[model samples]
Target: MLAAAAAAGAAIWLTTAWLLNTADHAREGTDRAKVRVDAVRTGLAAGAGAGAAVGLLLAFRRQRHAEIATTLSDYDAAERRVTELYNAAAEQLGSDKAPVRLTALYTLERLANNDPSHRQTIVNIICAYLRMPYTPPLDPTREADPEAAQRAAARRYHAVRGNARPAAQPTTTPNPNEERQVRLTAQRILLDHLKFDARVPWNKLDLDLTGATLLTFDLSNCTLSSARLSGATFHGTTDFRGLNLAGEARFDDTIFSGLTLFMEATFAGSANFGRAIFSRQTDFGGASFSMQTSFERATFSNVTNFGGVTFSKSFSFNGATFAGPALFSQMTSSERATFRGSTFSGYTEFNATMFKRDPAHELDETTSGWFDEFGELVFSRAADFSLATFSTEISLDGAIFSGDVSFRSATFSGNADFSKATFKQAVDFADAAVADLSSPPTLPAGWRIEPGEGATGLIVNT
Candidate 1:
């Protein structure tokens, strides 16, 4: 490029010097040469400028490629570091020392917090830790209690039969009390991500803590994709209030050693509590089950409530036993709700419970208008409301008891109506009670009220 510029400059200087030496009326050849020289210099200067611009363009391309390569290398290094830390933490979980295990859990938590992609995998690891076999601390109160001893024996027998636990922990394991703290920490970490926190929110976590022994486990106001807790044992009071389970919740054979509350929970998929034992007072009031729910063969040893529950699909409590007073008031079922061969050994009430969502009430039935607001009361199959108590005014108006209905030893309070009830076969309230005689309960044909059990006991009069 410099050579081109020098050639152009020399051409111009020679033309200027030649023009100075030209005659007043220069020859035609000299003027023609001057024009030729001027054109050559202009072309040389333009080509040099174009050449310089191309050089800079090539340099910029080289710089951009270098920057991209550096960025990619840095990214690769970061990923490797994360993988190393993750592997180390996971390995530490298997350590025999409680402190080492606890440290591992916290490290995993921090890693998940920083990297959202690893959150689900970390959650699974935490759950796997919880699934390890654990034995609870001995309760002095239950040490010698015969009932407690029986329950413990039954739990152990069932665990062995179901293969819910390993053979036994090695004698080299850490102290139970110290291990409990580590397990609790794991539980808390799982809960933190499962819950919705604005600063640290995670979604779509599936939990499978099956056969794990939990202590005073309470998971409230949370959402779960699916909770597979079958064969798990809850050692103390457990609560699952206001929980929304989008998928199935399996608690089959779960044992609750103390009071349990599942108030206002929504189970969108099948909610199975088959053979579950609730040893103390339990409440499942105001819960909604969109699909089938089963409590078959379950035992509720104390007062139990199923009030204001709605079951969109079939509900089965076949062979369930309630040893204490139970209430099933203001319940609605879109499909069949059967309690075939179940036993209610205490005072049970089914006040204003609707068997079917939409049913036609007999025009002549004398049941209160409350039944009209919801629907008719129809027990499709044989039902036992024996030893039942009525707390407030109840209306059995426009009700149809299709199968052999037994209200033996039932009591009534306030006003009762038995008008227009179609009893299919052998329907009778053998020893039902009425609270007030001045305003006697309405009884249908072949059914009359008489003094039965308690101060306000009732019996049937034919």
Candidate 2:
């Protein structure tokens, strides 16, 4: 096209020059003809300049087109190569051999590193592999009678004395060990890529490890979009410290057989731990929930700590059971926090906890509305509420207390309701401050209140 444009420009310049020269010769003797000749010559130069400019523009455009074509061709070839490598690695993952599967995992990792667009897909594949049902191999000799097997082997060794060869030692199967190693490798690949400062961080990838039986599941300091670990079983310590979850976090029916840590984690979306079981120490200290947080029907079999947690939205522990010492000291709730129908079998502590209505929050117009609900909760052991502050109304209605309970030096800036609450043991409200005397909190039947000073302070006992 550029060549054609250059030829056309040349043709136009030559034709104009021929016509001007012919006209100049036709009127050579007149003064007007001299003026005309000079004018024609100038016109011919301008036309030639215009034509040359057109040719230059066309040439530039053609070069740009050619460069674009080359770039596209190269891109096509690179894409094809990437596709080939991806398919080959995916195929290797289907091999029965553990070594082949491990190789495939690494290959996929390499491919993902080179091509970021495929990172999420590769992550999905790796997680799917982990979700497959797998059992660690057992030693055959151990599965049978280990003592008999050992004795038989010893006898065979003794029988093969000087001339013959000794009996082979009992050999354990290699497949289970190999398979376990492969699974570990897959897990490591995920951790390596999920790091905050990783060379190829798969940012905000959704994890679907539902029903997967994982070992030492650690996702600490990582950011995720969502996670589906429902019904999953973790065999080792699970760490989720400092995790930032931007979407729903589902751990319903999950079992953590080891210590679980979620300290300083941030949940930007709803968090569900319904019916989950923590068999060991579980700590969620200093965590922040920006949305609804639920622990409904969950069980903590060992020490559970939730100190300094911040619940920005509604939080619930309805029907949850704490079998060990439960601590919620220094926790803060901006919205409604409920523990209705929950049971605390161990020492329960809510010392220095703060439940207040946010002044900036426009949702609750009534300053006297109840924001903390512990209705129908049962404290089987000693319960403490020392120095706890409730800025809005709080309800302990129908709660059952079988052990010593204290509300020493607690401050209720709003109504503190204890209507119909049952106390089988001594209850103390020494030095408790109630802001609203116009509608003072009700004490349980037979409870006695001792007034302090004139009518400003009261101490209740049951």
Candidate 3:
């Protein structure tokens, strides 16, 4: 303000002196002096206003920086607190007491529920815990009832036969029953959070349950991103009904020692069950595979059902063995479905099935292009399809069949190419329908096709 006043007074004085005539300016000095005083006051006020504005701007900038610093400090402290809690809970998970372990799992679950950023990490920790070896108590009920005792005895017998028991001895917690419940709690936590209709579903989480021993494990009606159950062992009945897998699902070399159900499951990505063993009844009824699927070298020891299934991409059952009754009736496929070099020991059914393979999918015409076991499509055992439908060219060239083959009342829409196929047992094609008269089926020397049931239907006489 003082500098502004001095500069304003000097400018006003110089202007007044220059504008006045010599005699008149000398007489108007008092008036010029009065004008200079008012100009000094106006400049002082303008300078004071500018200084106030600068002070306010600086004050606001300082406040904003302080706010930002406070926010950052609070965030850092919260992050450290969360890390400390996570570490403490993880340490508690290794406690010897089952109750303590359960508490730790619940604590981690609560933390995950509160903070979504930590959900996948929490899931990984739980999966790692499950991967730790576990052998279920003989009877899951752990009761003194007669039924429980009998099941326990049977399990013991099986154990002696080198059948199961992949779990390692618990070093900290020796009590198997308590540990089983703890593991079950952990599994329950996952299920509750991953349920299809869960209040807060943890979507798009990956599961790595490889080599875990699960008892009556049910993850039905859950949507998962990816799953790895390779080499895992499932005891008791395992249910995966209505499950949805968004990414690749692997069950390679897995063992299902009890009833296994995968009903109505949808796999958007590649699904594999290579070399898996199903010791009891296994049902995949109403399941759909949208991508590549394989059951190569898999063994189904008991009743196996794949009824009402759909495969939109490449599907293979190459070298698979069915020891009991296998039902593949009422199934649909949009791509090549291979059963090359497979063995069926019991009654096999493919009633009202549709096998449609596009010509472009014919990777190898001479030999079926399997993942690792490419060979001619051969049915080494019994195969019965009372009312099935073959939609494309089925090449059975150079195939050798040793068991009974029946295709009664089945419809063939394309070339039923079996030029060099040998049937050692009785082959039946009673009342079958052939749509492609231009490309007749190639049969053996003694076999003859004749008119039968309908105008388009035919029968094979051997």
Candidate 4:
């Protein structure tokens, strides 16, 4: 549009100049000459106006182009500075001094806050730092000898005072306490950015903490997209209370050496804990699983809780070993949930639990053959399923109960198979409801059988 305006203005000016020159050559005294002069003056005035408009338009265009060029230059400079700062901080992370590494971590965090485009990359760097092998310093105060504590304190004092003599050569290993502080700082950086109410939130960031050794890890009320913690070892209390996982959460082969809490967590995708080990008390109370969850071959060495959990998809505890009391009270499974081949070395409770399979719910081919299977499960202590309800077919085909077992008020809406189950101690089925009793549950011959009032199925007592 500007070019067209300029061209039209130039054309008008040139035409007016030609008209003026033609009028200037005519005789001046006659009426025709005067008319010619007046016409010449009018044409000259129009030419001047057109010239002014063209000048203004050109000036405006040049000013706008200059402004745009300045903006581009500024953007280029800002990008270069950001790159330089990022590179410098990254280099500092590789410094041999722990304090320098800590400073670098904070600098990277600030850079991420100021630059949203590189937030995820900065987070990945921090997680990668944490993924590196780290061992927490053992507390000397815990030792039986007082001399250990004194030695640790003296070393710390000397380091702080900078009075210790420098080594002739750089040591390959970092000071335990200094390295621990750096690791903790790195962990804090991640947690700070991941907070939901962060000033600069990094939401849905995928974490790769695989094989990382974390101490006193707490991620309560945080939201994550996905996490890979396979083979990671957690020390001290590891809290994941109220965590919201939007994608797969892998903890395969991970070890929790301290109390692990997952109370009220929501898993929107598959959760895998295959071959994991919990060396202390673990809690998953009131958690919700929206997809397939597996604890296959996992070992729980202390008390474990799964009370009030909701399984919206297939769940398995196959080949798992529970060495302490196991609680599944008030648990609900919307799809097939199995504990096949699991062993309970302590008392097991499934009181008031419900396993209902929705006929409208579709299962994949891999899970279509799954049922509420407890086949080959061994209960070393009392197993309780009092007041439990099963709306789908359930199988305990080859389970062995070393202690007393109870199904006192359980209701089975579908076929209940106990084809080869063994009850070595007293077994109770008082007032239990069964859908099909044609193939009665295998019971020891000496056990007494009684029928409850208005109950169609026979109750067993041993």
Number of colliding residue pairs in each model: 9, 0, 0, 0
Would you list the C-alpha lDDT of every candidate in the order shown? 0.74, 0.83, 0.80, 0.84
lDDT of 4 by residue, 236-304 (tens): 899999988999999999999999999999999999999999999999999999999999999999999
Show the lowest summed lDDT stretch of 10 residues, model 3: 368-377
lDDT of 3: 0.80
- Candidate 3 lDDT score at position 260: 97
TM-score for all models, in order of appearance: 0.65, 0.82, 0.80, 0.84
Off by over 4 Å in 2: 1-62, 136-174, 362-370, 445-462
Residue 105 displacement (Å), model 2: 1.4
What global local distance difference test value does model 4 have?
0.84
Please give, for residues 1-462, the per-residue lDDT of candidate 1 as tens digits.
464455545555555555444533455687766755655555555555555565566678779999999999888998898889878988899888889999999998998889899888888888888899989778523334688778867878899899898346346656677788898898777766667552576677788989999888877767888899999999878888888899999999999998899999999999999999999999999999999899988999998999888888767886788788778877776655556556666756665665543233222456533221101444445556665554334455455565666666665654556675567766668766676665566777866666544545455566
lDDT of 3 by residue, 60-94 (tens): 88899999999999999989998998888889888
Please report how far candidate 1 places residue 292 from its true position, in Å.
1.8
Candidate scoring better on lDDT of 2 and 3: 2
> Mind giving the per-residue lDDT tens digits that candidate 2 earns over 1-462?
566556656655676576666666564567647766665676666666666777788889989999999999999999899888778877888777888888999999988888788888988999998998877554422345589879987787777775566666666554666777788899888888787877778897988999997877888988889888999988778999999899999999999999999999999999999999999999999999999889999999999999999999888999999999999999998888899999999999999999887766646455444468888999999999888888776788889999998888887766677876888898888777765465466666655455555544565655
Q: Which candidate is the best by TM-score?
A: 4
Off-target runs (Cα >4 Å) in candidate 1 are 1-64, 139-172, 358-445, 448-462
Error of 4 at 362 (Å): 4.6
Q: RMSD to the native, candidate 2?
A: 5.2
* lDDT score at residue 344, model 4, on the 0-100 scale: 98
- Kindly report the root-mean-square deviation of model 4 from the true structure over all alpha carbons: 5.4
Sorted by TM-score, highest first, which candidate order results? 4, 2, 3, 1
